[model samples]
Target: MQTESVKLPRLITPLIDALTNVVVIENGAIVKNTLSETALTITNDMPQSLIDSLFQSDNPVVQHNQKAAEAAYTFKITANRTLEAPINLFIIQKDRNMSQNLTFIVGEHAGVTVNEYIYGNDGSTVDYVSQAVVEAAGKLDYHGIVNLDAASISSINRMVSVKQDGKAFIKTAQMGNGNTQQDTRIDLLGPLAIGEIKTVALSSAKQEVLIRSIIEHKAKHTEGLIEQYGVAADESFLMFEGVGKIHKGMSKSIAKQHNKGVVLGEKARLDANPLLLIDEYDVEAGHGAAIGQIDEEQLYYLMSRGLSEKDAQRLIINGYLHPLEKLLENDIVKKHIESLLENKTA
Candidate 1:
C-alpha cells in the first residue's frame, strides 16, 4: 500500500486554484507498482526503448493528455504470474481541475485486474488518460466508475494495444449528472488477439454525455466486440459513436458493435451510431444501433400487476442496467449504481 500527492504545475493552472490530491496505489503479490512525478516508473527488466515506446500513441486525445499530464502512476506484471487479488486505484477531486496519466504493462502469460474509481464535486473539471499494453498470451481486465456531481465536466481518454494471443476486457459505468465525454481505442496488433468493451451511461437534468470508441484489427484471427447502453431524462442528451475496423490483409478477423439507448422524458434526446469498416477478404464485421423510449406494453403489464407507474419505471430501469453489474463485480460499484438509480427515479 502506498499513497502520494501530486500538484499541478503553474503553467497549466488556469483561473482555478492549483489542484493537489492524494492517490492510493496497492500492489498485489504478483504485480509490481511504480510511482513518479513526471513519467511512468518501470521496474521490469524490459529494455528502456520498449518502455519509452509505450508512451507514444497516435491518438490525438492521448497525445494531448500525455502533454498535459503532471503526474503518472504505472503498474507492471511479470511473465507467467497471475495476481491473486485485484489492484484498486482511487482518485478524489477537490477545488481545481485534475490532469493525470496511468499506464499498465502486462508481461507474457501474465494476468491482472484493475478497478478504478473517480469522483468529484460540483463545477469541477477532470481530465484522465490511461494507456495499456499487453504482451503475447497476457490478459487484462479493467473496470472503471465515474460519478461526478451536477454541473461538473469530465473527459476520459484511453488507448490499449494487445499483442499476439493477448486478451483485454474493459467495462465502464458513467453515472454522472453533468457533462462528460469518453474516448477509447483498442488495437489488436497481433494474431489471435481479442478485445471486449462495454459501457453504460446515465444523464439527467440538462446534462450532456458523449461516448466514442474504436476497435481496430490489424492481424489475422483477431476479434473485437463493443457494446454501449445509455439512458436519458429531463431534457438531457446522450450520444454513442462506435466503429470497428479491419485492416487490409487481416483475414479471419471478426468485429462487432452494438449501441442502444432509452429515453425516459419527452424532451430528452438520444443518438446511437455503430459503424463497421473492412478492407480485407474473408473477414466478418457488423454493427447495429437503436435509440428509443421504454416499451409502453411492458409498463402497462407491470402496472396491471398492482405496481405504481413510478415503481414500474424503476423496475424497468433496474432490469436495463442489471447487465452492467455483472461486469463490475464489486460491492462498492454496485452500491454506487444503486444510489444513482434511486436518485434518477426519485
Candidate 2:
C-alpha cells in the first residue's frame, strides 16, 4: 500500500517519522504496510499450529479474540541481528466493532524494539490480542500507547514467553477517556530469563479503566518485576493490579511487584493491588501498593508561588509521569506521550 494514498492521524504523524517500519490496521483490515531500514519480516498469515505452539493462554477474552480476529499479523525478527530502529504498528478503530491479533517472534540472539499505538473514534469497540515469543539470548523492548475516543470501549490482552537468557522489557502508557480493560502476562520459561513490565496511565471524565500485569518465574535464576502508576480525576475509576509468581524448584529466582495511584477529584476512585505468590523457599518475592489523593501541602505550596490551581495540578501530574521519558528510546515518541498527557490533564 502507498503511504501517500492513506491519510494518517495528526497525533501519530510525528511517531511515524521516527520509526522506519510502519504498519497500519484500520477497522479490522490492513490498510498500509510499509517496511524499510529494519531487519524484520512482516506477514499477514501464519500456520495455526505455529500460533498454537508459540502462545498459550486460559484467558477467555484472549482466546475469543484470537479466533474471531478480523486481521491477523506476525512480525519476525532476523536471528543474531541487533536493530537500532523501532517498528511502529498503528491500529485505528472507527465507527465499528473490530478485533485484531498480532504475534511477534524474536529469533535467537536477535534484538528488536516495537512501538504499538491504538486509537479509537466514533464510539467504536475494539478487541486487541497480542503474543510474543523470544528465543534464546534474544531481547525484545516493547512499548504500547492506548488513546481512545471518549465513548469508545476496548479490551486488550498481551502474552509473552522468554527462553534461556532472553529478556523482555515492556512499558505501556494509557490515556483513558473511555472504558478499557488491559491484561498482560509474561512467562520466564527458561533459565536466566528476565522480564520487566511498567505502566503509566491517566483516567478522567467518568472513564472506567483497569490494568493488570502478571509475571511468572518458571525456571531457576529467572527474574521478573511489575510496576504501575496511574492518576484518576473527574469521577473516573482506575485500578492497577500486579502479580508475581515464583514456581517451586526455581531456586534463586526473584519476583517483585509495585503499584501506586493518585486521585485528583473527591469522587474519583483509585485502587491498587500488588500480589506475590512464591512456592520456592529459596526464591525472593515481595509486593507493595499505595493509593491516595495528591498531597494538599504540595498543591498549597505551588499555589503560594503564584501558580494557578489548574497549573499547579498539571505540574504535579507531569511530575508523576515524566519518569517514563527515560524508559523510551525515541525522542518523538516521548514527546507524543507528553502531548497526550498534557491534553488529558488539561
Candidate 3:
C-alpha cells in the first residue's frame, strides 16, 4: 500500500473499457464512486498485459482483501473503502497464452457482482479461481459464463464463506463447440448462511463437460440448492458429480441436487452421479438426476402442425434452456445466453 497510488478509487487501472472513469478512495475510506447517467461505463477495462503489470507492481491501488496463484493472472480488486454500491469486475482472455488469478473481499453490509468470461482464439486451457471472503452480514453474487470454442479447458474454483445472516449466490452458463471441460466447487460455511448455485452447459459434436459441486453445511439453519442442467448434440458427452452433506449439529440444513440432461445422438453419452452424505436427523437433503432423449411424439405433434423436425428440435432445446434464461436479469447478458443456446440448436 503506497501513499500515492492508494489515492485512486480502484486498485486496477481502467484499460479495456475506455468508457470507464476514475474512482476516488483513500485509506479505508471511499472518497467517491459515481458516474453520470450519460456515462457508458462506470467500471474500467484494461488489457491483460497491463493488469498483469499492476499485480506485479504490488503498489496497492485501493484496499483489496485479495490473493492468487503465482504468475498466471492480470487483475486484483478490493472494495474501494467499505464499498457502497455493488462493484462489478470483468475478466477476459483473448490470447491462447492468457491466464488469470483473482481474489475479492466483500465487507460487512457491502456486496459485489463478479462477472468472468474465458475464451481463446487458438484454443487455450486456463486454470483459475475467483475466491471471495464474505464478512458477517455481507453478500456476494457471482455470474460466470465460459464460451470455450473447440480445444479450450477452464475451471472455476470458487469458495464463499457466509456469516450468521449472510448469503452467497453463484450462477454459470457454459457452451462450447469442439472439445471443452469445466470444473466447479462451492461450500456454505456459517450458521444461518445460504448458498445457492445454478449451472447450464451445452455441448455439440465430440465436446465434453464434467460438472461437479459440493455443499457442506457447517452450522444450523444453513440452506443450499444446487441445480445443474446440460444439453448435448451430435455425439457430445456430459459427466456430472454432485455431493451434498450435513455434518453433526447442523440442524435444519436443506440441500437438494437435481440434474436433467438431453442427449440427441446415437453416439452421445451422459453420465450422472448424485450423492448425499447425511450425518444426523432433523435435516432435509436429497438428489435427483435424469438423462434422456427428446420425445419423438412431441416432435411429431409439432410436425403435424406444419413445423419441420429441425424446427421442432429447436423448440425442445430452447425449452431446456428457458429455466436458466429466466434467472438472468441483465439484458446484454441474457441476450448473449440466448445466442449461445441458439447456436446449439442446429
Cα RMSD, each candidate: 7.2, 2.7, 9.8
- Which predicted model would earn the best lDDT? 2
Ranking under TM-score, best-scoring first?
2, 1, 3
lDDT pick, better of 1 and 3: 1
* Per-residue accuracy of model 3 over 1-346 as CA lDDT, tens digit each: 1234322222123321322222332221223444332312332222344224322322231112123333232222233323333333334333343334454546666565555544333355555555455666667676666665566566545555566666777777776554544444445667778887777878877777777776778789888888888787778888877788889888899988988888888888888888889887999988898788887788899999999888888887776765455344555556666676777756
65-121: candidate 2 lDDT, tens digit per residue = 777788888889989988776777888776678888888989999998887899877
- In model 1, how large is the Cα lDDT of residue 25? 26
Worst 10 residues of 3 by lDDT: 57-66
For each candidate, the alpha-carbon lDDT, in order, equals 0.74, 0.82, 0.60
Candidate 1 residue 336 C-alpha distance from true site, Å:
2.2
**Candidate numbers sorted by lDDT from highest down:** 2, 1, 3
Q: Which residue pairs collide in model 1, if any?
A: none
lDDT minimum window of 10 residues, candidate 2: 1-10
lDDT of 3: 0.60
TM-score of each: 0.83, 0.91, 0.73
Candidate 1: global Cα-lDDT? 0.74
